[model samples]
Target chain A: LAKTTQPISMDSYEGQEVNITCSHNNIATNDYITWYQQFPSQGPRFIIQGYKTKVTNEVASLFIPADRKSSTLSLPRVSLSDTAVYYCLVGDGTHNTNAGKSTFGDGTTLTVKP
Target chain B: EAGVAQSPRYKIIEKRQSVAFWCNPISGHATLYWYQQILGQGPKLLIQFQNNGVVDDSQLPKDRFSAERLKGVDSTLKIQPAKLEDSAVYLCASSLDSRLAGRTGELFFGEGSRLTVL
Candidate 1:
């Protein structure tokens, strides 16, 4: 599993776009970047995933560079409901479905102010 | 569709006592995971099950923690001789069989069982 580093906390206002970047210097060739959002008292939920370049979903957008060394999760028009911790995971199922066993760091706590 | 279900959403016990949590994954899901989330930290994976078999449990504290997925659909995680540091939320998550999907699948999590070891 590739290790990821992200900010401890970030703040933004409602209706603004919030971008959280994660650094993974030792990413693997088969690794795919995935983002998950966790609310208070709730489990983390999938936000978006990308192998390279960019991938957008109804909830968020994931931008990955060609090197795949890092990835950014962009939440457009954020709301107070979006205040939660976000996790960046880099792995795939190539090695015995280990992706399902990927490690999670102390995620970046995003606070969306009204 | 019903999501993953966990029982005894909360448990409290003194140190050295035992506690157990039960979970039922979504129907047809083949992969199950148990994670421990301490306050102010990310959830750490303790074990993963592929159907009725164990796939990974290197992170589990074998001396104290144990988990089983008997029918490959529901699971139970037990902790004996609990310590104060074991106070945290025990989360159960499930996903489709990635081997059949040919790609990593998203995890569906339950509400979680919060354990408070005094």
Candidate 2:
């Protein structure tokens, strides 16, 4: 599994855009960049995933440079309800024949203030 | 579609006591996982099962923690002689087998079982 590094915490005001970056210098070719959002007392939920370049979804966008060493999760017009810890994980989503997959880092706690 | 279900939502026990958590994944899902999440830290994978068989349990503290998924449906995670550091939320997640053609592995997580060992 590839280890990921991201900010410990970030703060954003409502209606502002927030970007959380994750660095995985040792990412493998088969690894995919995935982000999960976890609220207090709840299990983490998938936000978006991408291998490279950019992928946008209804909730957020993921941007991966060609180097694949890092990626960014962009949330637009944030709301207070968006306050939660976001995790960036690198793994081969196409296969799961092994254990200890989807290792999550300390995660970036994004605090959305009104 | 029903999501992954886990219980008892919260548990409090004294040191050396034993506790168990149950989980029922969505129907037809073939893969299930157990994770432990400490306060302010990301979740750690404890075990993974594929169709009633253990796929990976490298991180499971076999000395004190045990989990089983029978008939490949519902599962149970147990902790014996609990310690104070074991006070974390146990999360259950399930995903379809990615080996299936055109399927991408996506994990569906439950509300998690919060455990506090006093």
Candidate 3:
């Protein structure tokens, strides 16, 4: 499992773009970067995942540099309801045998202000 | 489709007592997981089950905590002689499959069972 580091908290205003970065210096070759968002009293929801370069989805986008040492999650036009905790995890998603046991860090708390 | 279902949304018990939580995964799902979430922290995986079989339980406190997923559908987690630190939300999650492309590890989780040890 690759250890990940992220900001403890971030503040942003509505309609502004928000970006959260995660560092995983020890990421493995087969590891994939995954981001999850968790609202208050709810389970974490998958937002985006990528192996390298950039991957975009309707909800968010993930950018992974060639070095793979770090990655960033970009949220466009943030809203008050976007307030939640975001977690970045790096693991071998190719191996389903033990994927469910992946570790989750404390996560970054995003506060979307009105 | 109905998401994962859990029971007894809240539970209160005294130290040294026993408590149990139940979960029902989405139909046809093959992987189930039990996680513990302490306030202000991310959820910790306690156990994982793959169709009535245990996959990973390295983090589970076997001496006091035990879980079972019989018939590959519903599961139960039990704690004996609970302690103060055991007070947390117990989360149950399930995925259609564990394979990489099968579901990309996307998990559907229940509302969770909040336990308070007094």
Identify the leading candidate in terms of lDDT: 2
Name the lDDT value of residue A20 in candidate 2: 99
Ranking by lDDT: 2, 1, 3
Specify the poorest-scoring 10-residue window by lDDT in model 3 chain A: A92-101
Model 3 lDDT tens row, A1-114: 557899999999999999999998878666788888899877777788888999999999999999989999999999999999999877643124232334788999999998
Off by over 4 Å in 2: A93-100, B99-103
Residue A94: error of model 1 in Å?
Answer: 11
**Per-residue lDDT over A1-114 for candidate 2, one digit per residue giving the tens place of the 0 to 100 score:** 667899999999999999999998888766777888999989999889888899999999999999999999999999999999999887645224233255789999999888
Deviation in Å, model 3, residue B28 alpha carbon: 1.8
The DockQ-derived docking category for candidate 3 is medium
Cα error, candidate 2, residue A5 (Å): 0.3
lDDT by residue for model 3 (B50-104), tens = 8999988999999999999989999999999899999999999998667544245
lDDT of 2 by residue, B1-118 (tens): 9999999999999999999999999898888899999998888999989889998899999999999998889999999989999999999999887456434567889999999999
The reply for model 3, stretches above 4 Å from the true place, is A92-101, B99-103
Interface RMSD of 1: 2.7
RMSD for all candidates, in order, please: 2.0, 2.0, 2.2
